[model samples]
Target: MTNLNASHASHRNFILTGIPGTPDKNPWLAFPLGFLYTLTLLGIGTILAVIKVEPSLHEPMYYFLSILALTDVSLSMSTLPSMLSIYWFNAPEIAFDACIMQMFFIHVFGIVESGVLVSMAFDRFVAIRNPLHYVSILNHDVIRKIGIAILTRAVCVVFPVPFLIKCLPFCHSNVLSHSYCLHQNMMRLACASTRVNSLYGLIVVIFTLGLDVLLTLLSYVLTLKTVLGIVSRGERLKTLSTCLSHMSAVLLFYVPFMGASMIHRFWEHLSPVVNMVMADIYLLLLPVLNSIVYSVKTKQI
Candidate 1:
């Protein structure tokens, strides 16, 4: 047998650890996670339904909101099934292919979610900056193109990850850090040199998520600057109020993910349990929190 094929044959499966240090308590862990999942689905689902049914919401801003809802749903579903299986059924064993597939979806959807946030920031900018041209600039066709572009960019950026990881032979310990498959965590399981994988992952993240963050910030800055042009203080406050929900989404979406990334990078001394909890927070908090924020803060919703 060839060396590469032989190595591949040896490591076809992996184990997902739901949480560290409490093997016997795995089933109980399922309850809280399942509860959170239910709430997220309902909350985001309601937002989507409201947007779809309300004829008045057939505009650029709400269309982007719908895309955000869909992104959140995608993010939650990408990880929830395996996570539940791990904790509830003790089914932690996953084939290599399956693990890679899950990792691909999680990261791609995550990137798409970030891209959507950036697009919304741009929407806010245009609405506030060029109010007269808002309708004309961001018509239905433009919104559709923005959504497609976000998804396409996410797909193109993340499409290489599975293939990159799959090319590497994972003959080492096949245990993952959490219930879900994350690119960084999965890369650790490979026995081969993962320098290429790590470098590429870092580059993709920096270019996609990192770039999106910077641009989103620029959009908000410009938006705030434009809002300042309104003469009356009350008018300025009212104009900025329209952006509160989006600002909340941007905060909820980026903060935890950035925290998790930092933890992964600099603080390896922390317990695996801490990392696992942070991963859950990063994945669980964004969608659920964004749903509530938009539902409450958005007047039309």
Candidate 2:
């Protein structure tokens, strides 16, 4: 164990935990993790390829779905190296700089995922509420603009988190609570006052995930209202069916995410392994599930 307290923050290495209660089982755990990771990549790759190769699928809704798939793959890749190292080789040490960088990319992709989901919700709203002008309203130019805006917002919101974590001095054990680097986990290990970091983290979450969820809900509310106005019962059911996949994706993401956040805040007394599992489900399982959900629900995919 390196003495992190005696050394400068830059010189210290953080220990990444694989699983809290079962270090001996990490090697065995690698098999399932690797299988799921392979499934995730294959699933997302198929989606992107299908969307690109098919001329009929070049609509705004599929465009947003492509963005969501890209975000999921990026987020998964950001954490894959460290996770593989920990579970496969019993190698858990990560340099401070690498950890910070990992944390940055993870957060950036996460925010982008949220934004993409919101965009998908908006796509559903437009398509359901006004079917005739959906094409004109969400033309290619508009879709490109939405993509750029989502990326820009994600970068701006997460740009400060690395610097914020960098400025804090770490004078305690550097073992993180999860397999991957996260802003919340990293900030907790800092010895200095984390009031600013904590507050900023809260604000970022509220603005990104919280706002995204609210907008998604609002879009669905309006969508449901529109569905009710249609006279034909079959038409109403047909219209609602289109939203099922997006709704599933949203719940898959926000539910585990909110559960993990709540666990961090209110369930500290629970075993650290529980926290690790929740975080894993949010980061790893959600992507695979998203790919699966869209594939099963969307006939085009």
- TM-score top scorer: 2
lDDT of 1 by residue, 1-301 (tens): 6986775654788888876778888899788888888999999889888888999988789989999999998999999879877988889998888888999999999999999999999999998888899889999888888888989999998998888887887776888888888999988877778899889988998999999999999998898888888899999999999999999998888888888898888998999988877888778877888899999999989
Residue 256 displacement (Å), model 1: 1.1
Per-residue lDDT value at 154 in model 1: 90
Model 2: how large is the Cα RMSD against the reference?
2.2
Superposed by TM-score, candidate 1 places the C-alpha of residue 91 at a distance from the truth, in angstroms, of: 1.0
- Provide the global lDDT of candidate 2 against the true structure: 0.91
Best by lDDT: 2
lDDT of 1 at 195: 95
Question: Which run of 10 residues does model 1 get worst, by summed lDDT?
Answer: 1-10
Candidate 2 residue-wise lDDT, 167-276, digit = tens:
98887678888888999999888878999999999999998899998999999999999999999999999899999999999999888899899998889999987898
Give residue 44's lDDT in candidate 1 (0 to 100): 89
- By how many angstroms RMSD does model 1 differ from the true structure? 2.1
Name the regions of candidate 1 deviating beyond 4 angstroms: 1-10
TM-score, per-candidate, Cα-based: 0.95, 0.96
